[model samples]
Target: MGGNHTQIDFILLGITDSPCLQTPLFVLFLLIYIVTQVGNVGIIILVRVSPSLHTPMYFFLTHFAFTDICYSTVISPRMLADLLSEDKTISFTGCMMQLLTFAFFAISECHLLAMMAYDRHIAICHPLLYVTIISSRVCWQLVASSYLFAFLTAITCTWCTFGGSFCGPNSTDHFCELFPVLKLVCSDTHSSEMLIFAFITFNAVGAIVVIFLSYMSIIHTVLRMCSAQRRARAFHTCASHLMAVSMYFGTGFFMYLQPPSSHRSLDKVASIFYAVLIPMLNPFIYSLRNRVVMGSLVKCGRRIFSCWQHRSFLSSRTRTVHLK
Candidate 1:
């Protein structure tokens, strides 16, 4: 299979096969992708420029936005192209690369969410030690570790998946997802399937456990607070994160936790939820719910407008001088 494998290309069936649905789906997803990029990139830029957002919380958030951008990019452009193109073909190497990059960012996001939860837990549960616990060095280390672990896991999964022979059909129902691609493998896939299952379960469940415990402690801490103002403040700080985590893990568990034999056509819908919808929603979830981010956005907007006005005035003066 060596020589043949290098030349093989997989046909991705994409979200729908209906001719009528393609244009509308393309428009809808194109808008979503555009918003995903603008929103995530806006968050990154806001955090970078706003000193108020230079805290450990926003630090983690910037990385989270970046991860969303990356994984969303991995899926959306190709999916959009496939919607318009008659040939929905992706090279074998391209498919594997897509899987690897997407897995890396997606797994990184899981860990990043856990880290954000822990940051909130520290902020609310032990406010006195929050600064000490989540210092700059600690934040860097946590972010680095998350990416490192995700990369290792992604590479391992990719290797396991592509190591198997693919002499049979080269078409998959969805994008280059683990299970869908695995279905195309002609070799005995028991070991690969088991390995992928173990890794996915460990990543999802492990992150969820961390988030669960963190929020549980946070709940306990918030309940015991003597001041209602402090309690409301704590909940407000966590609300956006809770929404994001719920949407992410909820869709993730639905997509990956089931048996390969039980994977339905609905899995494609679930994939769209996490891979596309969640990323587009995350920036809004955080920014709209967050007073600090919203304030920063307003300030940035004013600055941009002020600069534009100044440039227009200067240009008008130049025109007047030339007319004279």
Candidate 2:
């Protein structure tokens, strides 16, 4: 019944409330967050610096890694802090902002993965036309469109979910998510819920459909390939992306597709899977099996080592010259 909802703060009852589990949970998430940042950032840096990674595939991959970094940052820090601190209060403005940013990146990533799948399809199916089909301009356009769509969708969802009376409890069982925040609204949320469901379906399910179709074509093409070695290479190239897609889409669908009434404690687990675990795992998923990425990492490491050695040698030479 408050007009100034902005002045109110919502207490986020994070993953666990047990006093004994707090410290251990904090340490676990802290490590996950650290690895998520380091791994995703490493991908971005390698793609930017390595000439071998300057292709359309890597271009999409670089943006995907950046998205993962952003998506994790939106949720992890607050969640990690809440795990340690007794007060898990998030201001209304902060909560809405988090929802907005999180939705934007999350939706963008869904579309980005779809785009990457299309890229792979083109590369595998029509190798010669891959360059012409997915040109630099087209890549930029695809990425921009993904972000634009995500931003508009985020604004709509955030507004629809929060543009109502909030007379209920100021505490949510999970993070500042659509369903949790909606539970606090005093107004009839049927329209907002329907609208959000449509958007989630469009973003998540739609992306899955696109990825599915693309991979189907890719598989058909690979299966028809005359060279067994080429077919093996094609499958290898796709394996990492497919793995990432399965995990991200699986957790996302599990979290969002259920009836709000059916949202159980497992919703939190699903949330953590897509929001925290997926980002941390994406780097390894994409890079570990990727020969190009692995080779680039080695090259980058050597370059860094050589630069450090050169700096040390220069410092020693300067000391000798000063003594002479």
Candidate 3:
């Protein structure tokens, strides 16, 4: 909306323009979108209703699940639609909005993961003072701050991204990504690119530093513990979070930090993973290994079955009374 983009009201998204790929891709992405929504929403509900999950860890988890759901919704539905439609176009406004929303959730998740690592650190290293240190107020503050930082990052990046000219190309080779969209600008994007690189670098470095320090401290504390059982449990508690961190950060690091040549083939795939698969898998990663969630699911199942049986019996008795 600034330099040379006045004529461009819509831009094409080249989401696999292959006729052979479109149908299969559409179905695949459709399934993924459904699964992502269901899994993340289930995790949110599980955390909300299960008393065992009402801790600082799960509080952060709930928000993590929520962020995943939101960003996926921002990208996936439109992507799915594009996969089927020949037009494959998104308005300039829609593209910028997607960039902004995606940036917010993506960065928020980075901070949330770091915060979770910190939570784990407190639980393991300073168990005695964990409650006092990470009370409800503190948890709220940490989550709030994570979102606030995300907002600032998104606003800054999005502003810089769209601040320039766009008279070069009206089509993107990939989905509407910050970097790819930057490539389409006719105006000098050096400054905006540098700004984005700086922000991404800083955010990534800051999160990694926090996570690394937290886990390093956790490892030291766990090693000092005498009981094998306690040590095993401590490690078990962190296993899911560590796995999630690795999956998320690994792809993200590769995508953003690597040279453009490396992304020629893997870019879309990596984007799909972070946008679609990771969010879907997070609930399973945390829930399948969790006794609390398993127990809660079982309890809920029993309650539902019992209620159904009661209603059935009531209906039978009413029929018998009426016949008599």
Candidate 3's TM-score reads 0.95
Relative to the true structure, candidate 2 reaches a TM of 0.95
Where does model 1 exceed 4 Å of error?
A: 1-7, 313-324
Summed backbone clashes in each candidate are 0, 0, 0
Candidate 3 runs further than 4 Å off: 5-7, 259-263
Return the top candidate by lDDT.
1
Query: Model 1 over residues 227-251: C-alpha lDDT tens digits?
Result: 9998999999999999999999999
Q: What digit string (tens of lDDT, one per residue) describes model 3 on residues 94-155?
A: 88899899999999999999999999999999999999999999999999999999999999
Work out the TM-score per prediction. 0.94, 0.95, 0.95
Ranking under lDDT, best-scoring first?
1, 2, 3
Q: lDDT tens digits, residues 62-147, model 2?
A: 89999999989999999988887878899889999999999999999999999999999999999999899999999999999999
